[model samples]
Target: MQHGIHPAYRPVVFRDRVGGLTFLTRSTATADRTVEWADGTTRPVVDVEVSSASHPFYTGNARVLDTAGRVERYHRRYGRGDGAGH
Candidate 1:
């Protein structure tokens, strides 16, 4: 570890906007916004679009992509031998 060359690491709150979830963790990232946490202290808050709370995979709401079907359709439409090494 080097001294005086690293970004400051401190507790930060990541807030998931869609799911309304907050997680407290240490990070070197900075945010201009601050939020009052449950523990009655204010910390820097970062707004995120997605997190485990609302992510489709983590929430078991994911839609299974029909990749094979899509590939087959693409092959049929484009004549499969278009230089993909078969």
Candidate 2:
């Protein structure tokens, strides 16, 4: 790796506002805001909208789409395009 060309990799805090979760991890991402972690150290903080805590799949709040029903409805409204009726 180059000495000065690569971005600084350091410990950063990721905050999920929706889930009210915060964690410390190493990342190349940076932020102007800083936060004091549990270890009594200040680190750059990044705000995120979605995380494992708030994501539907991770939290088991995902909705199963009715794809088959949609296809059936499309066939009824627009036909199957088999060219038999036309």
Q: How many steric clashes between backbone atoms does each model show?
A: 0, 0
For model 1, state the Cα shift of residue 79 in Å.
11
Model 2 over residues 1-80: C-alpha lDDT tens digits?
86999999999999999999899999999899999999899899999999998999999999999999999999999999
Q: Write the per-residue lDDT of candidate 1 for residues 3-83, one digit (tens) a residue.
A: 999999999999999999999999999999999999999999999999998999999999999999999999888778868
What lDDT, from 0 to 1, does candidate 1 have? Answer: 0.95
Q: Which stretch of 10 consecutive residues in model 1 shows the poorest summed lDDT?
A: 77-86
Stretches off by above 4 angstroms in model 2 are 80-82
Could you tell me every candidate's TM-score relative to the true structure?
0.74, 0.82
